[model samples]
Target: MKFFAGAAVLLLLFALAPFASVPAGHRGVMTTFGNPSDQVLSEGIHFRVPLAQKLNLVNVSIQKGEGEGDAASRDLQTVHTRIALNYHVKPEGAVSVFRDLGNEPGERIIIPAVQEAVKAVTARFTAEELIAKRTDVRDQIIAQLRERLARHAIVVDEFSIVNFNFSKSFNDAIEAKTTAEQLKLKAERDLQRIEVEAKQRVAQARAEAESLAIQRQQVTPELIRLREMENQRMAIDKWDGKLPNVAGGAVPFINVK
Candidate 1:
């Protein structure tokens, strides 16, 4: 009789084994006889058949992944880039995602999506444009990735380009081009300064010449004779009565009436 009682107890435990708890931020997929059911289980306690049904939890929270890959620019230069992606499996599509992509959707979907998106976007811009227009390139990549992954029920929260690398020869070429441009600008500024100085000198010479011409036009012989007579009259007024000195065979002030 005790043996039968123990067997009954074992059967009861087996029946209770299917009761399970789904944690927060997770959804459970129930598979019966190795076939996934369309109905999904939300967080909290649930019950299922012990041997015939299996429950797998799928995290519906946001997850992050990183990847690096090489691509070619429009200028045929090799560009290497690192990318960071934030994504999540749609809560409503958790069961479908799990059924289609299995447990790890990021590996099969997100990583390759990131790589292809980056390559496609990078190929549209030259190396210099890629550096200058980083935001545009990143936006293009994110948009493409979002569109592609949406079909698989993956939601892309955010995407970013972490780093970009070029070959040593390409870097050296860019540096050389920048240096040449700077030198050309400096030369242009110097030429402008020299031209301004030259113009200033020519203007100063023309002004001095005009001043001398104005003086020549105003002076006359009649004005010079009037100035000499005024000086003699002033001398005569200041002299005393005695004046008998003669020089150079002529008497001074002989015509003084």
Candidate 2:
């Protein structure tokens, strides 16, 4: 009984030895003698010798994460940006990334590549141009990032500028200059309007003087005779039992009624 009981205990202990459980979407890289070996474990229950051999859990699932902004312009301007990263372990290149950059992909590979690319692109643009042509800057960064990180199996989904800030003095100066230019334009328009009005007034005065001179020159004997005939006909029709006499002194006001 003792022998069988001892065997049973040993067997039970052996059965519960250290083993790695690799769920779905995961792979276990088996290592022997602290070095990567030829064997790989698929998704399921896996056992490794308690000490000699070990299993490293590697996620084979498509994963995604974001990196928030950090950087400064050459002229000491703050640049805030964010990048959304989409990446799947190169079901094949997993070993390569692991061999090269260890397990943490973002910290080791993606971040450095991004930082280098962003710095390289941003250095080419001035602070003002960066704020205005932000989309352009972002595109160049994305292109460079993809090209540089392609070897590491990291794919960038999108990148954007979150915030762009400039110095207060510079901003205020730009606004002030814009306002001054607008004021100058308005003054020029007003001056033109006043000059137009003056020219129109001079034209009106000239027209009136010319009209009077023509009338004065036309006052001849024939015109005076015609005027007298019209006045006499009007007087005959409008006579209200009174006679009007015009002397050389002054013509008195007549009451037509």
Candidate 3:
């Protein structure tokens, strides 16, 4: 009796094994005889066949991933790109996603989509444009990734370019080009300043020459004689009613005869 009761309880528990509990934020995939079924179980308690059916939980929540890739730009420059993305599998498509890509969809689906999208987008822009138009680049990448991964039932919530790296040679070349441009601009500004200064000096010299010419024109013989006559008249007006007598010097108004 004891052996039979023990067997009966064991069998009862085994029969009740179909009563399964799917955790929150997850959906259960039912597989019959090692083959996946189209039926999906939502979170909470569920039922399944004890011996022939198994329930596998698939997380339908948002997931984050990051990857790095290398691509060539339109200018033939090698670009190293690092990307971060947020994604989630559609609840409705969880079965298909699991059936197709298995549990970890990030490695197989999201990563490849990211790499291919980055390569495709980066090839459309030059190195300088890629750096200058980072927003546009990021948008294009996200668009491409969304479109590509949507086919696999993986929705891309957000995508970002974490970093862009270039070869040391390319960076050095860019620096040199920038320095050369700055030097050229400085040289042009200096040339403009020198030209302005030269024009000012020419104007000053011309003004001085014109002034000297005016002074020369004012110093004529007639003008000199007029000035002397004015001085003599002024001296006569100031003379007193007396004459100076000198023994050796000649008299002013009377001759010695």
* Most TM-score-accurate candidate: 1
- Summed backbone clashes in each candidate are 0, 0, 0
Better of 2 and 3 by TM-score: 3
lDDT scores of the candidates, listed in order = 0.90, 0.74, 0.89
**lDDT tens per residue, model 2, 1-257:** 99999999888767756677778876677777678754556778876777777777666676776666556676666555566656656555555566667867778877788778877777777777887788898899889888877788656666665555556776786689889999999999999999999999999999999999999998999999999999999988988965466667765765679
TM-score of each: 0.79, 0.63, 0.73
Task: Give one digit per residue, the lDDT tens place, for model 3 in 1-257.
Answer: 99999999989987769688889778889998989988878898877888888889888889888889899999999999988898888888889888999877887787777888899999999999999999999999988888888898889898889999999999999899999999999999999999999999999999999999999988989999999999999999998957876688667686558
List ranges where model 1 is wrong by over 4 Å: 1-16, 222-257
**lDDT per residue (tens digit) for residues 1-257 in model 1:** 99999999989877768688899999999888889989889999888898888888999999988889999999999999988889998888888888888878988888888888999999999999999999999999988988999998889999888999999999999999999999999999999999999999999999999999998898899988998999999998987978777667766656656
Candidate 2 error regions (>4 Å): 1-28, 37-55, 59-88, 181-228, 243-257
Worst 10 residues of 1 by lDDT: 247-256
Candidate 1 lDDT score at position 1: 100
lDDT of 2: 0.74
Query: How close is each model in CA RMSD to the real structure?
Result: 5.1, 6.3, 5.5
